[model samples]
Structures are given as C-alpha cells and as structure tokens.
Target: MPSPRLPEASFPLHLPHVWSGSEMGAQEGICAPSTHACLDAQLPGNGWPVGGVVEVLQAQPEDHVWRLLLPALGQAVQAHAGPVVLINAPREPFGPGLKAHGLPAERLLSIHADKPSARVWATEQALRCADVAAVLAWLPQVKSAELRRLHLASHQQERMFFVFRPLHVQADASPARLRVMVEGHEALKVHILKRRGPPLASPVLLAAQTGRLAELLQARKGRAAPPQAALPVKPITPTPSLAHLATAAIKGPAPGQQKIKEESNVERIASALDRIALPG
Candidate 1:
C-alpha cells in the first residue's frame, strides 16, 4: 500500500543567520571555563573563547601562568591532539615542574628566536598552524596593524593564540577577543582589561602550590648544577713599576744618562735590523 507523500520543503544551501542579544545562537560567545572556577565565573561566556586570540599583558613572562592554564591547556592538547608551542621563551622550561603538573615533555615544544622580528615571524607562523594546540609568544613591542594580522591568522586555525606583551599595553587598543594582564603574586592574579562583554573590575586569583613548588626545588637542589664553561684565562696584566713611571715622568733629553740610554736603544734596534736577512 502506497502512503500519501508530504510536500517537499527546500532550504537555502547557505543561510547566514544574523544574530542579536535577544535570540540565543551558537555563533555567539560560547566559552569553556577557565582552569579556575572563580575566574571562569568572571569571564565572558563563562570563560575565555576557545578559538580566539587572547593577548596576555604582563610585566614579566614566566611559567607561573602555566599553573593557571594547566587544566585548560591539558584539555586543549587532548582535544586537538597537538603540542603546545612556545615562541621566544624567556628561559628554558623546567621539565620536572611541567611533569608534576601533568603535561608531558612530548606535549611541549619551545622555539627560541632571539630577534624580535624573528620571534614575530615565528609567532605568526605558529599561530597559523592548525596542528598546534596553543601558542604563547612574548612580544615586547608590536604595531597595532601587525597584531591585527596576527589576530586574523590566529582565528584562521581556530586554535588558541596568546601574545604576551608588556603590561603597559593594557591601555593600548588591540584586536584580540580577550586581553588580560597576568601578574605574578603569591597567587596567580589575572585581570581582564579588555573583552567583548561587560567590563570586569576585579582581578581573579588562582592558588599556587607552595608545597609542590618547594618539593620540586628540593629535588632539583640535589642534582649538580651545570658546570659552567671555564672562562678564558685573561693574560696577566703586570702592574707597572714605580721606577718606570718615575723614569717616564722625568724630562726626556735633559738627563745626559737618559739620553745616552735612548741612543743605546736606537743602536740596538739598528743592529737588530742589520742582522735580519733581506729577500733577494
């Protein structure tokens, strides 16, 4: 038996749904929570945007931020199946600390570029690569246009891109979806200076494990420090004798004895020259 066929409904191939604050849309600011629940509550979308550029402004850039990011970054690496990339890191990463935090050595990659231009170039390139789970670049100075370009490149891959700039840039305008100042303290202090949502007034605090940090320090304390390469032995600079200085200070040809000594030196030099064999 043939059932009655319903009329077919056709929909457009590409329907761009423009959105507003009223209607709930997936395209809106949907965020994953930060590693810390308190911080997540403060941030827009409940947390930082997963697929946007985040500009991290700090007075100093050290691995301390990694503690706050450990939870989020661990998930990101697992989700994306890519290693976290670091560009122009200030110092070599402490491997034991990372291991203690649950991030393996294989999951991390550090690119050392001394020059600012090289660092910028490497940072941009790293941001564009979809294979990278996240990129942390320390950019002390950069143009707004260059940052915009980085923002564009960052979004293309839909991976997290973090540029660590000076805290002074907190006043400067940027194109990143999230801009926060990460300051070092007993606890990790983070303040969202800029974002797409309501203004944030207070800073978020993430606890630091003093015990684990101390234990790590203790463990490393036993290992012998890297033998510093021996510095070049400087030629011994002999102290000038008082006699030589006194002799030099005396008015030259006025002393007959000194004049005679000068003539003797000239004769010695001439005799030495005469003794030398000349080329035919």
Candidate 2:
C-alpha cells in the first residue's frame, strides 16, 4: 500500500455563513446617508440614488433653475468629500452666484464647453473622476441613451450627476431618477415631472434669492442687525440775484414780467448746476 486513505468525515470543515444584506446595508449606509434627508426624500438608496441621472428643466435663464437644485447638490457635497464639477454648455454658470448660494468657491470646478458633445464628454469624465463628488452638466439637449451612459458611469464611480436641460426636453422620457421643471417665482418652485417614488406631482417652494442650504446656514451664522436710518441732508437755496433785489425794492417790473424773469433765472441756475461737480 502506497498510502492510507483518510476518513472523509474526519476531514470535514466548519465555515461561517456570511449575510449579504447586513454587509450591503452597512456599506451603502456608510456611502449614502438617509435618503429622507435629501430633497423630496423620494430618491432611491435614501439619497440622490447614485449612478442615476437628474434633469433640471428651466423655462428661461432667469428662472433660477440652479437655485432649485442647490439643496440637493449642497447636501451631496456636504455628505461626500469630493469636488463638484459644473460643465457649462450653452452659457456660462455664474460662479459668484453659486458662491452666494453656499457652494464654496474652492469646492467647485467649472468647465465651459463650446459644443453639446464636448459638454457631455467633459461631464462624463468629471463624473468618473474619483475626486469629484458630483457633476452638473448644463446641456441644451440630452438623449435617453446619453443619460443611460451617464447613469452607468455614475454608478461605476459612485457619484451624483445632474443635468440642466432646456424646458423643451423635459417632456422626453429619460433614464434620470428624477426630472424637475424649475420655474421662476418670488420664490423658486420645483415641479416634479417624474420620480421613482411617491410625492409625485408635488411642488416644492424654495427662496429665489437664497438657496435652501444657504438660508439654513445663514440662520445659524446669526441674525443681521437692523439697518440704520440714513441721515437727512439739508437743502441749500441759491442766493437771489441783484436784479430780483432791485425789482423787490423798486417794484419796477409787472407781476408777469417778474415771473418770466424768475423762470429765466431758474433755467440759468439749472445749467450752472449741471456743469458743477458737487461733492458727495
């Protein structure tokens, strides 16, 4: 006999069963916080649903469409430690305006692309970058397939993506998790065009001047002091002319003539004032 056969029962091994849900939930929860905290709380995975697309529709440039998305973008930036990329396709995004909305200048990277294809490519690259937390693309039009591609890329990179499209394109079906149409008002109003969960057709009102995140942060920064009243300035009257004085003393001119002279003098005084550079 070359060797002795080992007993199969004696060689039995005990292995621990691993739970998938517990592991997945732990990982997902760590990456994406509670979805309820997000705008509308209708996104999947309790957040903006990473890897999915979000389309922002604007009636016009002045509609403050970006302000409407600020809440979600700001929250995502705060939650994730990565840069936020904004790709401008048609028009340049007001960087200072974004700063005023509470997105710090240091955290934002803006790219101006001349063409729509370039914008989409640049947006995709930004989304794929590990350093980027979110990518916002301002494109004129986006097809469903392009959105699907972005969604897949976002999923691969685990980043949030938003596209600002013209109002005309909002009616088109997309791969976006949420499609919002932003219209201007005294405050910004968001009409949910499509969503994955409940709260469909709900309109959310947000301050037009300041974003929801900015408002909350400003409230915490402390109240603004009452504005002080401006001091009243005294009006200065020009001295009467010698002719008027003589006329007053001698009663030389008729009432109508005096009125005409006064009008003439007023025109002269106005001309003189126009040439003078008065100190503030």
Candidate 3:
C-alpha cells in the first residue's frame, strides 16, 4: 500500500492575557479619579461617578447650563467609543453648539419625543442599550419613583446617565447619586445638591474654557502671589455721523437718485460719499 500522505502540522494559537475572576473582581466597581482635580473633589472618584445619575438643572433658558455637561460627555465619547443619545422633548438641542463643544457630531444620536413621559421612556430604553455610552435627556419633570427606575437601569447596564430638569422639584427627593445645579457663565459653577461618599456642601467651579476643575488650593496660591501691573488702555473709536448712517441705510439709492450700474457701483459710492463729506 502507498504510504499515507504526511499530514500538515498545525501551530497552536497563543492568546493574549485575559483577566481572571479574581483580577476582574478586584477592579470591579472601583471609581477612579478624573483628570481634573476639581471634578474629582465633588464626584465620588476623580471623574463622574460611574453607574450613577447626574442631574443638570437650569434656572432659565439663556443660562447655558449645557456647558457644564459637555466636558463629561466629551470625555465619555472619547473614552468609550460608544454613541451618545440626546433625548429632546422640550426644545431641540443645538447641534452646532455641541460640535463646537468638542463632541463628535457623527457619534451623537438625537431623539425628539412629543411628550415628557415618552422622552423619559426613550431615555431609559437607550440607557439599557449596550451600544450607547451615555444618555442625556432634557426632561421637564418626573416623579422620584420614575427616576429610581432609571437609576436601576443605569446600574444594570453600567452606563452613564444624565437628566436635565428645568426646575427644582422640592417634593421629589431625587434618588440619583449626584444632583448638580449647573449655572453657566465664562466659568460654570456646579453645586453639589447631593452626594453619597462626601459632604454635599462643597461647591465646585468648572472652567468652561478648560475642562479642568477649579482647585481651592490653587486659587489660594494664586491669591497669595503679587498682583501684576495693569496694561495701558487704548481710546475707543468714534461712531459714524447720523447723516452718513442715513445715506448708508438707503437700500438701493435715495428717492430721486439714479441707481448705479453694478460694474461702477464701488466708484459711484465713493464719489457720492466724497460729495457729501460727513464728520468722522
């Protein structure tokens, strides 16, 4: 009988290091401090407390409360590589503003719901989805029990969730781990309404320009340093004369004035302005 063809040898495959149960258990549910020192002070760990709900409240429409939220959301989008869901029920979120704030426009998925209840429902569903890294909902108002359900969902899915409430609900004791009132300005201030590990009295200032938290120690040090001399000021430019403004306001030309041809419009305007010279 002909000798059987020799079988080709197969090489064993090598797998990279995989964490054991013990190793994973040690790291499980541990909160790491955020890169920003100020944020870490208010939050449980360094950054935003994982598996917890944070509420962003605005006193008025023009307060720009969303500025306080963008840093954390931007961080999440970068770190997780997961889609961010924005649930808009009251008003449409400014997409361009979000993009300017450094959130990837393509990674944002916006959902517009007709009612507050529906908005809440959609937000809860999105939070449960594994594809989403974070869910930001602009909720009008909600019951404490309803919020608790969302909190449970967040924990179960291990996702970061934020609820933006327009007004403070005194009757409802929010079950969220962090209840923050964000007032917007050049620097956004975050008041810790409630927290678990630390006292809630401390107010944290989040620099809107930089995502860094404002450190009290650093501020104290800055105050101790000698102040610098003020720079020389420049004079303000004078406003244009009313007659010149009136001439400029004429859309095409004054009532009896002939319309200048498009080709020589620049020369014609210069001639007319020179003819009726106004004080600078």
lDDT by candidate, in order shown? 0.61, 0.54, 0.56
Model 1 Cα lDDT, one tens digit per residue, 1-280? 9997765555343344443333322333445556578887666666667666788887877667766666666666666645576766686556677766656554555655444655666566567655567777778877788788888887776767778888777778888877888876557788877665556668877786569875775676677667434223232221232122123222123433222122334443222222222112
lDDT of 3 by residue, 63-148 (tens): 25655566677767766644576666354345445656566455555555444565566567667766566787777666677788
Model 2 ranges off by over 4 Å: 1-47, 78-81, 89-102, 207-280
| Top-TM-score structure, candidate number | 1
TM-score of 1: 0.66
TM-score of each: 0.66, 0.55, 0.57
Number of backbone clashes in candidate 3 = 3
Better of 1 and 2 by lDDT: 1
Total backbone collisions for each predicted model:
0, 1, 3
User: What are the runs in model 1 whose C-alpha is more than 4 Å off?
Assistant: 1-32, 217-280
As a whole number from 0 to 100, the lDDT of residue 104 in candidate 3 is 49
Candidate 2 residue-wise lDDT, 174-242, digit = tens: 876667777765576667676544444567665535465456445634855454242232333322332
Model 3 / residue 257 / CA error / Å: 68
